[model samples]
Structure formats: structure tokens, C-alpha cells
Target chain A: MKAKIYIKYKEGILDPQGKTVHNALESMDIKDISCVTIGKYIEMDFDNISKESAELITEDSCKKLLANPNTESYTFEIVD
Target chain B: MKAKIYIKYKEGILDPQGKTVHNALESMDIKDISCVTIGKYIEMDFDNISKESAELITEDSCKKLLANPNTESYTFEIVD
Candidate 1:
């Protein structure tokens, strides 16, 4: 089985990198570009695991390894 | 309309944050967790834009504002 995890910064957090990119875009004459936020993606492939097992593994992964849970949020989908 | 953008680290890039999380997981007695990589998600909502126009806007937003296009890659989908 395979799972894809996406993690990103919280909406209200200050993202300096994103701000820099937004400024660069304005300098490049791109109009109406409001904002940008950055985060992470992880793809995991496991063998010999049932769907329920994968869900448990993924939940643990998110809590312990994948997301900070303080400043970031994560979502994942299992693939057949 | 709304667009969801996902950006992530390249496969080969070294993610120290991910590694740190992995190590923490190990210390917490979680096994079989091989590796972790992190990335970002950006959701944008725009008013008064056609789908084609949104595509163009998004492509330009990605190139100039949304993605670095060097160490990161991005994908965006338009929502009704």
C-alpha cells in the first residue's frame, strides 16, 4: 500500500519565505497575486499491511513524525 | 473559484526536519518508520475568473509566486 501525506503551515502564521516570493512576484509585474504559503509532502509505501494497519501507522506517523501539530496541519490519503 | 496548490521537496533533497521527526518517532518506540519528507499546501480563492483564465493565472502564480521551481515542484487544481 501507498500513502501520500501533505503538511502545511497554519493560516495565521507568519511565513517570511512566502512573503519574499510574493514580493518577487510583484516586482515581476504579476498583479492580483495575494499570498503564498509553503509546506511539505511525504509519500510512504509499505508492504504486507492491511488498510486498517496502514491507517494506524499513518496516524502515528502524523502525530510522531509527520506533523508538528503546533504550527502545521497534515492530511493523507491511502492508495491501492 | 478556488484553487488548491501543493508543493513539496524534491525526492533526493535532505530534509533535516523530517529526519529529526523520524528520530523522535524512534525514540518514542515507533518501529518500521523508514523515512519522512515534508512540503507545503496553498489554497487560493479568487472571484470573477474563468477556468482558462484561472489556469493562466495559476501557472503564472506558480512560476512567479507559488513555487520556487528549483528545489520544489507544485500542482494546482481549480475548484468550482
Candidate 2:
């Protein structure tokens, strides 16, 4: 099974890196780009893992290492 | 319209951050975590852009700012 995990900063949190990028875009004249937030994407492939098992593994992975739960949230998709 | 843009390091490129995370996972004894690669996710909402125009804008954003074309590739989806 293949799984894709997306971890992102929660809304309302300040993101300095994203701010820098947003300013850079503004400087380049890209209009109306209200805001930008940078996050992480992780894709993993495993053998003999069912969709249910993948979700369990993914949840554990996110809590154990993939994200800082206090500041970030994560979602995952199990691909057949 | 809302658009979610996912930018990731191309396969075969080394990702030091991901490597560190992978090692951390290993240290924690999280088994079967073959490898990990980290990337970016950007979600934006606009008041008045058509899907076709949003795709064009997204392509331009990826090329000019959201991604480093030399090392990363990006994909986007328009969400209503």
C-alpha cells in the first residue's frame, strides 16, 4: 500500500517562512496573494499493509515523528 | 475558488530534513519506515477566479515562486 501524508501549520499561527515567500511574491508583482503557509508532504509505500492498517500506521507516524501536534495538523490518504 | 498546491522534491534527490526525520523515527523504534521525503503544501482561496484561470495562475506560481523547478515539481487542485 501507498500512503500520502500532508502536514500543515494550523490557521492563525504565524509562519515566518511563508511570510517571506509571500513578500517575495508580492515584490515580483504577483497580485492578490493574500497569504501563504508552508507545510510538509510525505509519501510512503509499504508491502502487505491493508488500508486500515495503513491508517493506523499513518496516525502513529504523524504523532510520533511527522508533525508537532501542538502546532501542526496532518491528514493522510491510503492509495491502493 | 480554493486551490491546494502540493510541491515536492523529485525522486532521487536527497532530502536532508527527511533523512533526519527518518533517523529520528528509527531511533524511536518505529519499524518499516523505509524512507521519507518532505515537501510543501499551500492552500489558497480566491474570491473570483475561474477554474481555468486558476490553473494558469497555479502553473505560473509554481514556476515563479512556489517551487524550485530545478529540483521540485508541483501539482494543484481547484476546490470549490
Candidate 3:
């Protein structure tokens, strides 16, 4: 199985990195962008695990290590 | 318009961060993961630009700043 997880800061959390990129883009004349945000993308391949097991592992990983629940949220999808 | 961009390291490049996470997960007993990779996800909202313009800007940004073309590749989708 394969899983992809996206972890992003929750709404209202200040994202300094994202802000820096936004400014950089504007200075580069890539105009018309109203907003820009950045996050983490993780991909994992599992060794012949069932879909349920993959889901459990993915969720647990997100909660335990991949995401900071108080400041960030994560969503993941599993595929065989 | 809104755009979502994913930037990932090219094949054969070493991903130390991913490796560290893999080890951590193993120590935490979240076994059976064969591989783990990490990347960047960027979200941008545009101010009523045409799709073609959005595409051009996105590609330019990826080449200029958002991605290190020597080691990373990027893909993006734009929607209204």
C-alpha cells in the first residue's frame, strides 16, 4: 500500500515561511496572487499491509509525529 | 483562481529528513513502512487571472524560487 499525507498549519496561524515566499514572488513580478501558503507532503509505501492497517498507521503517524495537533492539521489517503 | 503545487525531490536523491522520520516511526513500532519521502506543498490564490496566466506564473515561480530544479520537480493545478 501507498499513502500520501498533507500536513498544514491551521487557519489563523502565522506562516512566516509562506509570507516570505509570497513577498519573493511579488518582487519577481509574479503578480495577481492574492495569497500563498506552504505545507508538508509525505509519501509512504507499506509492505503488503491491509487497507485498514495502512489507514491506522497513517493516522497514528500523523497524530504522533507528522503533525502538531494544536497548530497543524493533517489528512491522508491510502491506496493499494 | 487557486493553485496547488507539489514539489518533490527527484529520484536517487537522498532525503535525510524522510529517513529520520522512518527511523522514528520504526522506533515507535509503526512498522511495515517500506519507504518514506517528503516534499513541499504550496497553495496560492490568484486575483481573477486567466488560466494561461496562472500556468505561466506557476511555472516561472517553480523554476525561479519554489523548487530547486537540479534536485526537485514540481507540478501544479489551477482552478477557479
Task: Indicate which candidate wins on lDDT.
Answer: 3
Residue A17 error for model 3, in Å?
A: 0.5
lDDT of 3 by residue, A1-80 (tens): 89989888899999999999999999988889888899998999999879999999999999999999999988888977
Candidates ranked by TM-score, best first?
A: 3, 2, 1
lDDT of 1 by residue, B21-68 (tens): 667767887656566555667765556778777777778888875667
Candidate numbers, best lDDT first, in rank order: 3, 2, 1
Candidate 1 off by > 4 Å? B9-20, B64-71
Question: Candidate 3 at A40: error in angstroms?
Answer: 0.3
Candidates 2 and 3 compared: the better one by lDDT is 3
Global lDDT of each candidate: 0.73, 0.80, 0.91
lDDT of 1 by residue, A7-77 (tens): 77887988787677667767887655556566667766666778878778888888875678889888889
What pairs collide in candidate 3?
A: none
- Candidates, DockQ: 0.45, 0.62, 0.86
Tally clashes: model 3. 0
The runs of at least 3 residues in candidate 3 whose Cα sits more than 4 Å from the true structure, single-residue gaps closed, are none
Clashes of 1: 7
**What TM-score does chain A reach in every model?**
0.85, 0.93, 0.96
State which docking tier applies to candidate 3: high
